[model samples]
Target: MNLPNKLTLMRVLLIPVFLVFFLIPGIPCHYLLAMIVFIAASITDALDGHLARKHNLVTNFGKFLDPLADKVLVMTALACFVDNQMIGVIPFLIIMMREFMVSGLRLVAANSGTVIAAGFWGKLKTAFTMVTIIAILVYLSFSGDFNSFSLACADTIDRVCGWILTGLVWISAGLTVISGWIYLRGYWKFIDPEA
Candidate 1:
């Protein structure tokens, strides 16, 4: 109910609006619209955390919901990309696998009365993932233009974007895997094989 928590909720609320803009057909500049919505949500993601720490408004609810909102927002975009064939399935699967591993590790830590904060690598992965999504949306927005020049170089642009996006996906996936491993290893003692 605090400002930071409200911002987190706002980020979550914007996800459906992003989907509406992203998934619906025939909307003028739909990709651009979705990108704007996504960017707005991303800003809130940053703002909430900053405000939470700056003003000492951090709460258990904020801690729980902020990361959950981030994961949901990111995974939803990745799912849309895969469903639309904008990206390959492997990167999506890899990111999702990392999320599952991290979430399970968090559960183990929580049960042991320990809280695991996001590490540097995890933050880097999230930042890179958001930037990649924005880049792809920017590409899509321009690609939808049917200007003569664009039409003439459509294949070339598509090919270039394809390679760039793939590289971005793999880079993000690599970070996710590294961060997941770090989190798991750091808290391995909390996870008991006997349990």
Candidate 2:
């Protein structure tokens, strides 16, 4: 396998490692370790694509697995957040709903010998989602230290983090809905039974 495909596979391999760090109890700085692993895996997502196009190493497997890896990594993080109460159940279901819808759309398109690639809005959603996940992880990782600050400072910090984290989550959720709409609209013909 070429380096690009290797990188893609490596990213898939790293997901479990990232989760291991994120989920394991009582590890020192495990959240930080998870973030590092996640960020590294995220980097490979871009690098593999860049190298694939530059070196003409793109393959069907890469095309399929690249996005799958991204979704798996992101959804895993979101699931972890939901488990930890960093995010609400409704938002979690919203994200998962969009993912399922898109996956269904893709399966339909594939059955019809068509490939519905990720669009700009989808990419935007992914970028925002990754950033949101990282921010939440950072916030949750150090939230315990909020008690160390003075009352005013703690309140200020809490307010700021709350606004940032909440805004990121909503923005990412909005983008998810938009991107899903775009995908469905763009490929509606594939989904139309009479056409």
Candidate 3:
């Protein structure tokens, strides 16, 4: 396997670690650990693609699995956040619906002898999603500290983070829709019913 593919696999390996950090309760610094792990995994996502392109080591397997890995990691994180009640259901639904729709469209394009690749908007969406998830997780990790006080500082921080997360979620969702449309448009010419 090429370095890029190895990096992609490393990202897949980190998913469980990320989840573990997110789920662990009252670990003193669980939120910080989760944020660090998530950031590292997000970095690997970028490094894999850059290495694949710059080193001329891109492979068919990488092409097929890289995006799939991204989708899985992102969708997993989103589900976990929703399950933990860190984010709203509407945003999760929008983001997940876009992912499913795009994945289905990509499959259709693949069968039609075309590969739909991630564009700028898609990358931006991923970045925003990662940022939002990290922020929300960190907030959750600290919200426990506010349980005793009527006007706790932790509660204030959580509310601020909540607003920021909501904004990021909407931005990510908008970008997801735009990116999906771009890919669909690119593949439209090749998707013939008779073919």
Residue 85, candidate 3: how far off, in angstroms?
Answer: 1.0
Q: Kindly list the per-residue Cα lDDT of model 2 for residues 1-195, writing each as its tens digit.
A: 889889999999999998899888577778878888988999999899999999999898987888888889999999998888777777777788999899899988899899887789998999999989988877766764233445668788878888888888988999999999999889889878888
Q: Rank the candidates by lDDT, best first.
A: 1, 2, 3
TM for candidate 1 is 0.95
Q: How many residue pairs collide in each prediction?
A: 0, 0, 0
Cα-based RMSD of candidate 3: 2.7
* 20: Cα error in model 3, Å: 1.4
Off by over 4 Å in 2: 144-152
Candidate 1's error at 78, in angstroms?
0.4
TM-score of each: 0.95, 0.91, 0.86
Error of 3 at 11 (Å): 0.6
Overall local distance difference test of candidate 2: 0.86
Candidate 2 similarity to native, TM-score: 0.91
